[model samples]
Target: MSKIVMFDMDGTLLDLSFDDFIWNECLPERHAKIHQLPLSESKEKLYQFYQSHRHTLVWYSSTYWTKTVGVDVLKLQQEFQSKIQARSGCIELLQQLKEQGYICWLVTNADRASLRLKLDNIAIEHFFDVIISSEQVGYAKEDINFWQELQRLHPFNPDETIFIDDTATVLKTAEKFGIQHLFNISQPSSLKDIKQHQDLEFKTLDRLTELLSILNEIDRKDNDVKIA
Candidate 1:
């Protein structure tokens, strides 16, 4: 079986503080200034607008939001580049996964511009065997059709692959595509409490070593049975 491991970028590998800062703080502040409304009112209004297209591809498009919100999101992100960083222990986890012979791919809903910015900021781009953006695939990860297209372009057996993501909605879509090994990152943002989910969740990337050990043992036993 192909030991392919797919990772989500924003929350899984990178700290989500940057995104939270943009959506919850920067954009809202900009909206308040542009519309001459109170900050709180602008925040509420923009948040409602954000929710209206939460699961769609447009939600992840930096350019789309920039136009819609009448703000330069990409420029704002650059201004707050200090907030873009990898989650603690993520680099170690990626190294361990590579040493264990797993093919690691970064699969994210982030648009190309955002992806490039974050990757450059963290300098962890070389860690991934391939980085795939949902924008390139013409679908959001929340759609099963996106997974189908992903598999078509970069083939892997869903049963043999493991996918780790912070978003429950995207995980559900991956499950619908019959991905057997799934994990949820309970703590996507350090500022927030661990997000509850029905599936097994990891609080940090440090648990990755143990998780891979268990998978390796299971694979060993299965191999032994086949030999016998």
Candidate 2:
């Protein structure tokens, strides 16, 4: 099997955070302005409502936000696409890994449309061999089935693959699916105490080049023969 590296997009390859930037700043602000609600009151209420339904489309969809927030989903999604990147640094890491021999891929929970908007805005689509989201898999990353499906599509052996994400729950699910290699992101806020189970867990790196160098050395050593 080919050596493959799969990364979670939201907090691992991209920046850590729930991407509330749009809901917190843009969407509510736009809705308040357009609907003539008190800007401060609207921003406050909308932000609070968004927080209430965090990790859900229940508030953001026509079934909910359209009635409660009084805005079109299409329009709000457009507005969200306008302010996509709330943080930085991951694009450079992606570039470095792509230049190295590793076949990099992205596995995320973000829905397809939102995922496309983020990738398009960042102009980093070409780096990934494939982008799979939990929505398409019909399960969250917490389920072993999600990764079993990933294997069905990509066909990479668990031994040769390293999966990285910010959630321990999902990492455990990966292990259940037979992925022995895993990394919980090192960022404190995103940290999941992955040390006991991970091959490597580092918060910051001077360069991805360093990772590549280590991999090269391992490959060279593995290829060298030993006298019995």
The best candidate in terms of lDDT: 1
Which portions of model 1 miss their true places by more than 4 Å?
Answer: 196-210
Candidate 1 lDDT tens digits, 1-228 = 448889999988888878998889998998889879999999888889888999999999989988888888899898999888788778888887788777889999999999999988887788788799999999999999999999899888887777888887898899889997777776777788765544444322334444566668757876898899
For model 2, residues 1-228, the per-residue Cα lDDT tens digits are 346878787666654333545555666677888888887888888768877875443532343666677766445656656555523456666677777667888888776666776787767778888888777776677777788887887788886676777666778788888875666655522323423434444222333233455556645654673331
Candidate 2 Cα outliers beyond 4 Å, as residue runs: 24-74, 80-82, 86-89, 188-228
State how far residue 69 of model 2 sits from its true place (Å): 6.5
Which residue pairs collide, candidate 1? none
Task: Estimate the TM-score of every prediction.
Answer: 0.91, 0.66
